[model samples]
Target: MTLKSPISIYDAQGLAFGILMASLGVTFLKAAALVTGQTAGAAVLLSYLLPLDFGVFFVLISLPFFWLSWVRRSASFTLRTITAVVGISVVSPLLGAFIRFETLPPFLAAILAGACSGVGLIALFRHGASAGGLGILALIVEERTGFRTGWFQMCFDAVIFALALLVLPLDGVLYSCIGAMVLNAIIGWNFRVAQAMPAQQVG
Candidate 1:
């Protein structure tokens, strides 16, 4: 399906929903002591070891990618991605405070996080934004060559998970891999753009 050129008001709402879901997913992963990949994983890892906030780390990690977004993509795309990153960074901790999971099982947390991240990423992709880090790189690669962003992300995730083995328990690594796969699978299956259509027409 082809989306309109200029972003619609409905898509703006979708952007908000996508950010919210993605933030919630990150929060769940953090609570479960699991890490996915990319900026989110880095932020979670930092928040674990340092006296830093995940929101701050999330936004900080994403800052460097804006340069790539602006140079390879467009100002509008860069701005939108910045907005998405900021929104997720700010909202995640707020959600964490109130949405307490008293006894969230690791498996359940992994599934919930995966589903949220997958659906949220699809929404962001449809609206021409992403959560930054490998997301920005994936989007750019997908735009330049008709490659799938999800697969790109999965490759990056593999590296992240490999490093994660040093810090995370085997069970946590297993669940993280599962969540990562779920996230990329949703994008690969649903967020594909046709060869004839423009990359922006990805709704």
Candidate 2:
């Protein structure tokens, strides 16, 4: 996930951290110069290559998906997603001014990014909201086309990583994959928890 300033060239960590935070993921991929999957990943990758701020790119890339979400999903879903996206674009940049990482390794940063994102995303889900991106499209495809969501995500990740190779070092790509894996694992495990536990127990 990432957050950055539009007025400055800013740091890549903000872009990476921002993309994650917008989706409720924490920011660490940027510290390791890593990228991710989905719309956030694409935005992060673009921020690395372009002069635009991460938030600006995040909003631009999300516009089409927001339209799809409005057409395919409920209006409520789209509204909440818009709120979350705007919140991320605004709030994430402030995190850096408050919290600073003194020293973080690529492996550790990846892990933290996943863990924080997983937890944050769960909270968003509980509130009936989403960050929206490829995720919205993935869900639409899965429901309407009978495609598996997992497979869809995997394919997207594969593409993101492939492109990441051109921009990031091999180790950076590898670490980013690890972060993505951790995020998925946390999501999977928690979904099971959400399903199996009573609503009270889930809390």
Candidate 3:
């Protein structure tokens, strides 16, 4: 098969918006003392347990996924994925400075965080990039089996949350479960819509 076209400058620009939205969502999650799944979720867990920065943990966790992207996708794709991961790491921490929440209800934070990050992730996927970790595997599985990437991501998130239940309080894990469902649902719904439509239109 021929190689897919490299992402254009426009799509790269689009990834920035995606990264920003995803970062903002994570910011909310952190503020509410919630943990998610995927690379972002892992970062949240580590940030809670360690003195490390969330962004730093995010980028560090993403490193292993680069090999998967390179082997399954393309060099261009791997590069863009790297950029997206780094962008998220850098922006997530900075977002706290500009946006402060005095008291965000856990349920509200979960839903809103999920929605925002889900939209951001969709944008990254469409542009041939991801936030790394299970996201890379999700894309690969989706491309092969026509499975929903969101479902694959959700499965990964489930495992993370199962572990999270051990580390986080009951309420936090409960809210996280809700947020994970919302996040994956958005991605699954939108991905189905994209598949049903023409590529040009989806873009």
Q: What is the C-alpha lDDT of each candidate?
A: 0.81, 0.64, 0.83
Q: How far does residue 126 in candidate 2 sit from its true spot (Å)?
A: 2.9
Going through the candidates in the order shown, the clash numbers are 0, 13, 0
Q: Encode model 2's per-residue lDDT on 1-203: one tens digit a residue.
A: 11112312232233334345544343466555677787778888888899975667778889998888777665655665676676666565566446667888989888877777656554444443456787677655655665644456667788889989999999989988888777666655554323322232110
Candidate 2, residue 196: how far the Cα is off, in Å: 11
Worst 10 residues of 3 by lDDT: 194-203
Q: Give the top-scoring candidate (lDDT).
A: 3
Summed over model 2, clashes come to 13
CA displacement after TM-score superposition, residue 88 of candidate 3 (Å) = 0.3
Q: What residue pairs are clashing in model 3?
A: none
| Candidate scoring better on lDDT of 1 and 3 | 3
Q: Return the TM-score for each candidate structure.
A: 0.90, 0.76, 0.90
**Every candidate's CA RMSD:** 3.7, 9.4, 3.4
Candidate 3 residue lDDT tens string, 107-201? 99999999999999888877767888888878777767888888888888888998898889999999999999999999998875335322332
Cα-lDDT of candidate 3: 0.83
Quote the lDDT for 8 in model 1.
70
